[model samples]
Target: MASRSLADFSHPQDFILSILQASPSTRDSRSYLSSFAPPVSVESPSQTPALDVLPDSVPDSASSSAPRTPKPANPLVASLLNPIIRRPALVKIQGPFTDAQLNSIARGMAQLQKLGLVSVIVVDRDDIPVSEPSDAASASRQRTLVLRDVERLVHFLGRHRAPARPILATVARLAGEEEDDTAAEEEKRTPGEVFVEREGLDHIRRAVEEGEIPVLLPVALDPGCRSRRTGADKVLGALASSMSSAAPSTSASGRRTNLTPLRLLVINREGGIPSYARAGLPHLSINLASELDYIRGTFLPQWSHTHPTALSNLALANACLQHMPREASALVVSHRSPAAMIANLITNKPAHSASLPHALLVESEGRVTRDTPTLIRRGLPVRVLRSLAEVDIPRLTALLEKSFRRTLSAEGFYRRLETDLDFVIVIGDYAGAAVVTREDDGTEEGICYLDKFAVLPSHQGDGTVDFLWVALRDETYGLGLADASNPSIGSLSGKGRGRDLVWRSRADNPVNKWYFERSNGFTKSADGKWKMFWCDAEQRLREKAKEAGREFGGGRLARIVEDEERGRLDRWAPVIQSIKSAWV
Candidate 1:
C-alpha cells in the first residue's frame, strides 16, 4: 500500500545486516573471491586462521554478518560524574601552620600576585583574601590584606598539619652544651646580683617553706584557643615535693622552737582612725616609751614583721624580754583602757633596774594624791591606776597580799604558823588581812596573809565593795595601825612591811575563780582549799566583840577586853599577853 518503513521489516537484525553489507566500509570483493564456497575438510586446523578482510555483500547463507566500530573516551562525562574531584580554586587547609610552610605560602602568594592572574586569594574559614597586585592603588590594597592575613594563614596551616616529633637526643645534646654557658653566666654574677635577680622567686620559696600560703599556676593548653598554654604537671609535682620537705617536723627535736602563735596590735591614737580600729584595739600600743623601755632596748630587734598587728603582740613581748639588759627590769602600768590593760599584761616588765627582775605590777590610785603619798613613802614607784576604788585599790591590795603570802608559803612559813603561832588578826575586810601569833618565847611575831577577796558578781558594778575597802584602809590608818613601824600584825611582819595587803576568794566560790587569774588564795598551796590562820589574843577579842554585835568603831575595840576576860582569854592567854602590850 505505501512504501514499507524499516519498522515493517520481518526481522530487524536481518535488515540492519543487509544495510551493513551494502556499505563500502564493510564490503570487500577480494575476500569474496577467495571464499566463494564452504569449507570441504572436517579436520581441525593446527593454527588459528586470522580474519583478513570483510565481505562486500552478504552470502546467500550468511545474510546477518556485519562489522561494529569502537566507542571513544568521554572527557566531559568523567569530569561531571567523578565524586572525588574538587575545584582548584576552592582548595583550602586549616592551621596551625609550621614556620617553613608559612614562609613557603608567603612566597607562593607573592608569586601569584606577581603574575597578575589571581583576582582574590581567599582564606576559607575567615573568608577574607589578599588582593591581587595590579595598579599602584591595587598594590596598596593588597599590602593591607597581606599584613592582616599573614598571621591568620600561618595559624590555619598549623592546625591542619600533624605535630612534629621532638628529637630527644638532639635536645639533650644542646642542653648539655648550654650547661657550660649557664655556668659561665653564673660565675660572672656577683652574690648581690644573683640575689636581686632571684628575689621574687626566693620570697615565694620562703613562703612555701614557712607553710604560709598556697601557690597556684596554670597547667595545660586550651583546645578552643590555640595561643593559650598551661603549666606542666611535672612542675607542680616538684612544688609538692618541696612543700613536703619544708613541712614542720613533728618529732620533739624537729619541732618549731616557737610554736605558739604571737598576738600583736598597733594603735594610732591620733585622729582619722576607722571605726574598725576598735576591734583591733586589744593589740594596740602599750605606753611604749615609759612602760616598755627595757623591751625596746633588747628583744624587738630580732623579731620579724611577718604577721598582721593582731598576731605580733606576743612576739614583740618575747623580743622585749630577750633584749632586756641584765641590769634592767620591765614594769607595766595600765590605765582605764582595755587596750592599755592588755598591752601592759603582755609586756610583763619589772619595776626596779638594780634587781633586773623579769616582771612587775605597779597599781596606781589614779593621779597621785595626799593619800598616795603614804604609798610613795613606802618605797613604791608611781603607776597609773585603772580604777579609783574598784579595780585599782582592791586589785593592788590583793596583789600585794598574794605576793607576801606566796613568799612566806614558799619559805615553809604558813605550815609552821598553823601550830607554833597563837592567834591570827584580819586587819581589814579587804585583802589587807594579817595573822599575829605568840612565839614559844612569848614574843609576838606577825605574818601578813593575802586572802582572795572578790566583789559579788551582782555587786561588782555598784562600787559598794570598792568604797568599803577605801574606808577600811583609811580607818585602819587613822587608828595608827597603817604605819609600817606600828606593832599591828601586818606591820609587825618585817618581811612584808609596807606591802601587807592580799585579796583572794574562797576555794568553793566558782564565780570568784572565773574572774580572778588564779582562785587559789595568796600562795600556790592555797589553791582549791580553805585558808585558815592563827592570830594574837587581841585580834581574837576583836573578832568576838564584832560577833557580839558591836559597831565598826573604836567602841568595838573597847568591848573586846570585857568579852575576853569572861572566858575567851582562857584559850588565848599567850596571844593576849603578847599583843595586848602593843595595843596599850
Candidate 2:
C-alpha cells in the first residue's frame, strides 16, 4: 500500500496521475483515470468492479473510520444556573412517502426511543408523526419535549418552559408545514369569490355604503326576501328614482326677444315737400334746391321735350310722392319756380291724389333774379319770407298738421305706389319750385312724363348724359323698381307709400324712351321707342317677374325671373283657395 498527504502534491492533476501510476496493476484505478481524461473510452458499470472499500494502511486521522464522541454540554450554562439542561431528540420524515413514509416515520421514532430521547409518538391527519416516539423517548429521558408540527410544538414549548435543546430546526420545520397548509387553503378558493376580509362588520357596512362593491339584485319576486338579499340594490334604486325626480326640465323658456322699433325717412322735391315720420327714430325728408342751369344746359338739349319748367316741377313732385309717408303727411314750401303748377299736379295725380290730404302746400317767396321779382305775389296760403332764415316753428307746425290730414285717405294708394317705384330724388330745397315725374313709367304705357332735362354744350361730348342714364338705371335696379315683387320691393310696403323720386336733366332722365332703349331696354314699340318701361303697378310687377324668372313664358323672360318666385306664383292658386276655404 502507498499513501501521501494532500499537501505533498504539487498540483491536483499531478497528484491524480501519480496515484494512477502507483496503482497500475489495479483495474479499477486504470478505469477511473481513463474516464477522467478526454478522448478515452471507459466501459460501463456492469463491466467494472465497485471501489467502495478503502485500504487499512491509511492514517486514522485522514480516514472516515475516526472515532466519534458525544459533545459535552457547556459548563457556562451550569455556572449561570439558568435551568436544568437536557437534549431533545430530533427525527426528520421525508414527505410524498405515503405508507412507506409512515413506516419510515415509525422507524425514526423507534430509533429515538432506543436512544432514550422520547417516550411516545403522536401522528397528524396525514399519518406523519407530529411527535415521533423515538424523539419523545429521548426527550422524556432527557427531561425535554420534541414536537414536529409547529402548532403542537408551540403548545409543548408553552407547557414545558424548562431548559431544552435549541428549537430552531423544529421551529423551521413547523413554519414550513404551516406555509404548506396556507397554500392549500388558498388554492381551494375561487377568483371571483376572493375579497379582502375587513376587521369589523362596521367596516364592511361602510364599504357597501360607499359603493366600493357593486350591488347584486336578486331574481326573486318576493319583495321582502329580495330586499333582504340585495340591500344595496334597493338603496341604489331609491336613490336613482329620487335623483330623477329632482332633475330640472330642459324645455324652460329662456330665449331673448327683439323689441326695437323701425325708423324711415323720405324726401320729395317735386312739391318742395318734406315728410317726417317715426317708429323708433324719426324718418325725415329734407329737399334741397335744384341747379336749374345744370338741368337746362346739361339735360334739356339731350331730349326733345316741351314745357321744360312744367316737366321739372313734375319731376320734383314725383320725387316728393315716392317718399310720402302712408299714414303721415308732407309739408310743401314753394320757392323760385311755378310752385302751384307742381303742387296742383301732385295733388291731382292718381297716386298722389289719394295721399294729397297728407300734403300741405306752403307758398314761398319767389327768388329775385335779373329777370324776376324778389317778392312774388302770394297765391295759395302764401307766406312772405325774406330768406330761408325766416322759417319758424309755428309755420312748420301748421304745414305739418295740414299735410297730415290730407294724407289720411291716401294711405293705401301711397303704400301701393311705394311698392312700385324706385328711390325718390329731390332736386331743389323743399321750399323751392320743382317738378315731379314717375321714373321709367313714361314709355311703358304710351304716357311719357318727361321732367326737366337738358344737354349742356360744354359737357355734351363728356358723356354726362350717358352717365346720368346709367345712374338712373342703377338706382332703378337698386330700389327694386326694376323687378316687381322682388325681395327688395317687398321691403317698402307700409308707411313708405306716397314717396316719389325725381330726375332733372334729359341726360340723366330715366323717363326718356330713347335713353331707355340705349341702356339695354331692347324691347321696341311700333314707333321704334322703348316698349319695356315701368309705368303702372301691374306693368312694373309683370316686368319685374319676367326679369326675375318668375314669369310663365320661357326664353329671356324665364331666365330673368327667379326660381323661388316662380314656385310661389305657381302655388298661389292653392294658397288663394285655402284662404277662401275652398278646394282648388
Candidate 3:
C-alpha cells in the first residue's frame, strides 16, 4: 500500500470503488457478496390448508412434542448450516465518547449479542489502526480498544463451551463522521473534523485524509476460518450480499452459497481534503449525532438519550446494511428509514398514506365496558371459529342492519370473510362476533383489519360487545379474533410480529373515544371522513418478550403467534423456511 495524500488520489472514487466491488487485490480470499443473493428457483406453491368448512372434532398439536426435522430433499436448512466464511463486525471508536455512553451502548449490544445479532468493535481514537502505547513505561495501564473488551468477554463466555476465534471484519470509524458525502461535496470540507471536536481524533482524521493510503478491514481478519459466521441468528430476516453495487433484487433469505470476498477501503487526502472526497462515493454518509437521537427514542426506551452508544450503533447498522457488498437491500427496507434498524417489517410508526381504501366503519351506540363490565356469563361461551361453516347468514344480516341502521353488505361480507377471514371470536351462540381479515388491503399495509365488529341489536346495550372485546384482547391481539396457537399465519396475517391491528371509525362516531383508548395510536388520513385506529401487536409482543427476558423484535413476534394445533406448527416450519429464503 503506497502512502499518498487523501486529496492526492488522481481518481477520487478509488477507495469507495474498492469497497463496493470487493476488488481482487483487496478482496477477501472467499467471496461474501454473492452469499446473500437470492437463490434461483421456480415458484413453489404454498400448501395452505384447504379452505373448506371443518367438523367440530379435530386433533390438537399444542402439547405434542414432535420432531420437525426436514426430509432428505430439504436443502434450506443445509444452507443455514453452511460454515461461516467471514462474519462482519462493524464498530466505531470515538474521542470524548464517555464511559457512561459506552455502558448504554453495551446494554443494546449485549441484547444483540445474546440474540447472536452482531459482534461489535470500538477502537480507541489514539489506536485508530489498533497500535500499542507509545509511552511504553505505562503501556499496560489501559486496554482501551472495544475489540479487546469484546474478546475478553467472549473468552469469559466461551469458558464453559468451545474456544474459537470469530472470523470477523471490524470496520472502524469516529462518531462524528458517517459517510463520504461531506468530502465529496462541491464545497469540500471534512464533515467528521467539524463534528468531532476532540484534538486526538482530529489528528487521526487528518492522517488518513493526508496520507492517501487506504485502510482496509477485510484482510485484517482470518478469512480462511470456517466456523459459525456472524449473524447466523437472523437468517430469517437476515438477507446479505458480498457485492457492493448490486442493484435491488426481489427479497428472500438465501443460504450462504459462496465464501468469496470482503472488501472496503479508506485513503489519505491532501493536507486539505483532496478534491476526491466529494467525488463519486456510492453510499450515504450517516449523520451520527442526528441518527443517534432517533435510535435512542425509538428502540431502546430505557436508555433514550443521545450518547456515544448511539453513534456506535449507527456504525453497526451501516456495516450490516450499507457496507455489505450489496447483500442487505432485501432485509433492509431502508427506502426512507428513520433509524438504522435490523429490519422494518412492523413498526408502531405508520408510513404516511396518500389514498384511503374503501372499508366501512359505522358508529353504533353500545354499552361502555368501564361503566358496566360484563364477562361471558355461564352458558353463553366465547367460541373461536376458524371458518363460517356454522354461521347463520340471515341472523348475521339482521344483526348488522339493526345495529348500524344501514343496509348490510351481506353477500360481500360473507364472501370477504369466507375468502380473507383469518379467524373470528364470537360471543355465546353468535350474539356478537369480531371478524378479522388476513388480507384487508392486499398490500403491505400489513393490517389485521377489523373487517366486522358488530353485536346483534338484542345483545348491544347489555355489554356483550364489551365482554367480547375484553376476552379478545386477553386471548388474541386487539379486535380479539385469532389465537396464539398458529402464529405461522404471520405471512397471511401481516408482516412478521409487530403487525398493525387496525380499523377505521368515523371521526364523529361515538366509538372513536373507545377506539382511541384501546389502540396504540391512530391517524386521520388526508380524507377527514375516517380516523384510523390501530394496536401494534408487536409493541405489546415486545413488552411480553421483555417480561420473559427474551430477545425482542420481529423474530419473537413471528414465533409467538404460531398455530400449535394438529402439527400446524410442524407443517409450517418448512413453509416458513422456504418463505424466509424466497426471492421476490
Please name the candidate that would achieve the greatest TM-score relative to the true structure. Answer: 3
lDDT of 1 by residue, 34-147 (tens): 122122222322322111110111111111111224223322222112212111010112122344444444333222112111111222111223222446676455434433
lDDT of 1 at 83: 18
Write one digit per residue (lDDT tens) for candidate 2, span 438-476: 433223322122221222222221122322222232233
Of the candidates numbered 2 and 3, which has the greater TM-score value?
Answer: 3
Task: Give TM-scores for every candidate, taking all chains together and pairing residue i with residue i.
Answer: 0.16, 0.15, 0.27
Span of ten consecutive residues with least summed lDDT in model 1:
371-380
- Residue 558 shift from truth in candidate 1, angstroms: 28
lDDT for model 1 comes to 0.23
- Which has the better lDDT: candidate 1, or candidate 2? 1
Candidate 2 overall lDDT versus native? 0.22
Give the 10-residue window scoring lowest on summed lDDT in candidate 3: 353-362
Report lDDT (CA) for all predictions: 0.23, 0.22, 0.32
Candidate topping lDDT? 3
Deviation of model 3 at 201, angstroms:
93
Distance (Å) between predicted and true CA of 383, model 2?
A: 24
Q: Which window of 10 residues has the lowest lDDT sum in candidate 2?
A: 353-362
